[model samples]
Target: MGNTSVVLRNVSKQFHRKTSGPLTALSDVNLEIAPGEIYALVGPSGCGKSTILNLVAGFDHPTGGSVTVDGQPVSRPGPDRGVVFQEHGLFPWLTAMDNVRFGLDVRKIPDSAEKAQYFLRAVGLAGFEKHYPRELSGGMRQRVALARVLANGPSVILMDEPFGALDAQTRLSMQELLLDVWTEFRPTILFITHDVDEAIFVADRIGVMTTRPGRIMTELRSALPRPRTYHDLASAEFGRLKEQILMSIREVIAAKTE
Candidate 1:
């Protein structure tokens, strides 16, 4: 039963300010994500959701406590964890295929070109491999970015509002594509998003964080079955879960104002 993929034990993060003094971003945040589990985090605008991702990605260190993956501490970014951001962080100079091949090259993996093509095709961008980031649409660029991450074959994925910038229709399509890819790869994911519906749609469990100096307020398990579709969003079970999360968020907001 020892299948913990990632763990944050009483983690806290604080930012030192020159004028405002020390600012606490996260406080005593404890979380455990099981191997291959898709866990989503939702919270208020400034509630340290992205900060948590930064810590997990090893872009930043916690002020207190510890962050670990697979029983080992995370001191720096490694090949075991892959990250995707809100903006498609692709190089304009590199073609789609090359961007995907970048990580493979770093790892000195043979057949990198072929591997890149496979992942690009997996993300439905086969013919667009030669297209530069400037030549691709926002959605396509993001697809390339995702292909880059997937090509790395990391055991854990950290996504920070990956589809937040897309339009409604495009975002839904991306969501479907993500679920399909996730079903195939089954990597443990820690997804941070403000959209409750998106969290419920893609995650096995939804973690809600409180206001400033953020900490997980509660975690809600998704009863919705796998191979989920847009149609499932209209189900009674979906509405029930949405309302439950909405209520919790409302409570947090109310507390913040008071």
Candidate 2:
């Protein structure tokens, strides 16, 4: 995937509930993620963080304003945008290698066998190509999901709490693997997570969203050194950033309650 820039201009999303009529999930949200950058969105539950990712991924459209990738308007899902959800979403019947190859095959991409094998190896699933989703561990299934996306040659990778379902240790390992793969592939990423520490650990910049009718409450650049490790989680700098983000979120929650 080539480096691509993502821009959201005054974006708003409204959903109609059967009982509530129209509900605004996001209101006048604006953001920009530069080429090859990792941007994570974190906020209170139902803050529309995933809504932002869905809009950027072209899975849904904003009722107002625009979303563009590399200056082109986003109207629908395309090969240029690949998404990974909290659920692995792999085929039950397909082998790990075949699941990845399915994406390339859909795109009519040549050399899918080689590409599938390459990404499986990249995600540390080199020997599990023949394993089915049911046979693999949670982490391995997520790796397959990731490999499927990477194999598609997308310019942007949209992840919606992809590690949220994992155990603490596996989550940490997946976070580390994600950073390593991001460094190697350099695809622009838009990640949505509830964990503030996870956001701080993996992102180049973190955006805190306001309580629903969500908007960017604040944006913080992460200064923690790269090739980050578990040890870095205990560092003063990491703690400082964590505190800053938590304080911002606490303010949002406090205001809501008041």
Candidate 3:
């Protein structure tokens, strides 16, 4: 409903190999993510989904074309864009609260401890604030990572397979946690995942990408009513949409193998 928070125009990325020929990761990628909407990028392994996230985060530059956040060209990473990577990336030395406050400290924000506790509570880690990263489970560490990012109050959140490392049950719980957080914060999210079910579960729109030299193959709007539950997956409409997405991805994989 709000303006576009992130935009990619003809974005392409290439990695040069010293021994082998040049490798192309993404080609001619163009997409606009609306503010407060959850968008999922689903693709096969090595299909450049993470590359796209990096570009948006300004962690890596595109070899061709451009990426923009809030109508301005993204040339470097900033507080305006918060990234949650697949790895928790928490500091082992820091407690959960300290890890969440790390960014605020770097930014020289006053009252870092107060801001950190607010976000830690928001992510359901209020009581465990004193625990170090090693003391927490994989999912809890990720929650701390999410809290760290959210505490900064970025306009856009770019996630690259943030839940891919978790077990099925934990992944579902994290999805629900993310949904609750999104409902409250309303930050524009661009999440990357290979799981079709996960995409449908979390996204307002799903973008399927090709195997390599990845490009947006299709954008499917999720018409399923919000506040989604696992029970929705058993419904006829959910099955129909899942089947369609599976078929499309299957074709792309088959073509790549041929």
Candidate 4:
């Protein structure tokens, strides 16, 4: 799929429950992700990071404003956009290759096996094709999950805390793998994460959000250089960006507490 741009304009979302009145998940949240750019959103929990992703993913609708992709309004989920949650979201009964093949099969796309296998290899899971989710480790399962998303060839990939559950080392490895995959496939990405370091490491630009009535507080364009490596994690610019994001988060939390 060719790269495409995503735009969220004055987006706001409110959820109403019978007993709790109305809760505002987002308020006047505006965001733009350039074609093929990796944009990460970092915010305190319940700050609507996932809410923003959901809106763009067409899983939910905003109460106000518009969500568009390639200048067209997003009304429902489409093949042009793909989403990967923190959970692998793979079928336990399906083999790695089968899970990757599922979407293509549903869409009636031809050459499904070939494409699925190719992506599995791309994610470093070449020989594990027949293994079920239960047979694999956490990191391996995630690799399969990622391969599934890429196999579909979406122009935009929306990730919600995709690496949050992995151990630190595995998480780092997946981060590197994601960059490698991005470099080759070049999909516009909106990544949601709570880890400051992770946000700085993976994003081309990182957006930090304010408390409760979530909205972007600031956005930092990363300069640590790409085809990112663990070595970049120690660079001064990385540390500087990390600290800036952390301070912003702290301030948001502090304000919430107050």
Candidate 5:
């Protein structure tokens, strides 16, 4: 594609350690996501999956190279990029609609309340608008969190294990719901997850990373067709991709252990 939505060129990030020299988190990592494409990153713990996410979200700066979205360098978090962390990060006292409305209100978006309601409905939380975060189930709270992001109408949606906390069944439903939202809004998504199946389920391409000083070991393009269902998870092609990713991850970990 001539125009890329999210781009990271030779990106590297390091953090100063208390007792040692700088700790490298990522090294010379490069990734490009086309507009409306869903890209996923999967790797072992401490492999800098979240580090890559934070870089693009503009929550942190890289030590070298560049991070850009929509052809512009990212210096700080902006409304153009929406992020959903593993935790729902909702206000405990706020109702679902209010939680979704919070961002719109912060941006001073016109008709904030109405936009919040519409997004809540879009995420299948129509009747739960009045439910407080404490009153809602884990899945519902996550739905509200997702609605809040969608309401912002971001060009790039950055997610770090957004559904990793849910139970198996709830997580499946949420995965399906995510696909529906992606189809409707078509925001370029950068998803970071520990689950290989989840990555295959939601991503157009998946990058597997090494254990430390995280670098992409390989990238796999999803061959499974979209509007994907759990039934598709049983297909030979899905199993093949999952097997390939798992094998790659295992090899990396095994090499480190050896």
Candidate 6:
């Protein structure tokens, strides 16, 4: 991993509407993501968290400023940045194995089947390779989605509420799975979520964003010891940090409603 994985300088995004007028989604958003670190953006719904991810993934262009990955401006989607969206976005017709192999196939990688299987196993889906997305459980399907992105060997992972659809138990399990995968791969991750605990548990740095026309309100470094486990959440220190974040977020929410 390199020193700095991504940088956004004064980035802003505006969506032109036909009747409602221009929608300012992001405003002067500046952020830095260090290599091998997990940085999360947490905010209320419609606060433009996904818009930030879209800009980084080049799914959409910023109306102002710049977004750079590995020192290069992001102009379009590339294999260097892999995205896992809330919707798995898997091909319904393709089997788990084929889904993971899709990126490799697109890149014309030799022996893509072998590489795909390796990633399937890495994400704990080895035995379900032949199963199509519809045949798999929601959690299993998401595992395939995550593996597919990882198989491409992206330097940065952009996740937009990837676990939001799962049930509580499944969500917790997926979080642990993500931690395991992240510990091993150490890819720079920018995860966007509405869940406060999820952000605190998963991120090395938590960025709180204000409501629409969103700008970063505050950034907090997680000083908690790493190799974190569920037990850590019960600790007094964890509770204190969680309280602080909750307070900050609540303030943002309150201000937006007023």
Per candidate, the number of residue pairs that clash is 0, 0, 0, 0, 0, 0
Cα misplacement distance, residue 104 of candidate 6 (Å): 0.9
Worst 10 residues of 4 by lDDT: 1-10
- Point out where model 3 deviates above 4 Å: none
Instruction: Give the per-residue lDDT of model 3 (tens digit) for 15-115.
Output: 99999989999999999999899999987889899999999998899999989999999999999999998999999999999999899999899999999
Residue 175 deviation, candidate 6, in Å? 0.5
- Candidate 2 lDDT at 114 equals 97
- Which candidate achieves the best TM-score against the true structure? 1
Give the higher-TM-score candidate: 1 or 4.
1
Where model 1 places Cα greater than 4 Å from the true spot, the runs are: none
lDDT of all predictions, in order shown?
0.94, 0.93, 0.92, 0.92, 0.93, 0.92
Q: Weakest 10 consecutive residues, lDDT, candidate 6?
A: 1-10
> lDDT at 124 for candidate 3?
92
Candidate 2 lDDT score at position 218: 96
Off by over 4 Å in 5: none
Question: How accurate locally is residue 111 in candidate 2, as Cα lDDT from 0 to 100?
Answer: 96
Candidate 3 similarity to native, TM-score: 0.97
Cα lDDT tens digits for candidate 2, 6-115: 99899999998999699999999989899989999999999999999888888899999999998899989999999999999999999999999997888688999999
Across residues 163-233, which tens digit of lDDT does each residue of candidate 6 receive? 99999999999999999999999999999998888988898999999888899999998877778898888
lDDT of 4 by residue, 1-258 (tens): 124499989999999989979999899998888999999999888899999999998999999999999888999999889898899999999999999999999989999999999999999999999999999999999999999989888899999999989999999999999999999999999999988888898899999999879999999999988778888988999989988988888998898889
Clashing pairs in 3: none
Regions more than 4 Å wrong, model 2: 1-4
Q: What TM-score fits each model? A: 0.98, 0.97, 0.97, 0.97, 0.98, 0.97
- Model 5 reaches what TM-score against the true structure? 0.98
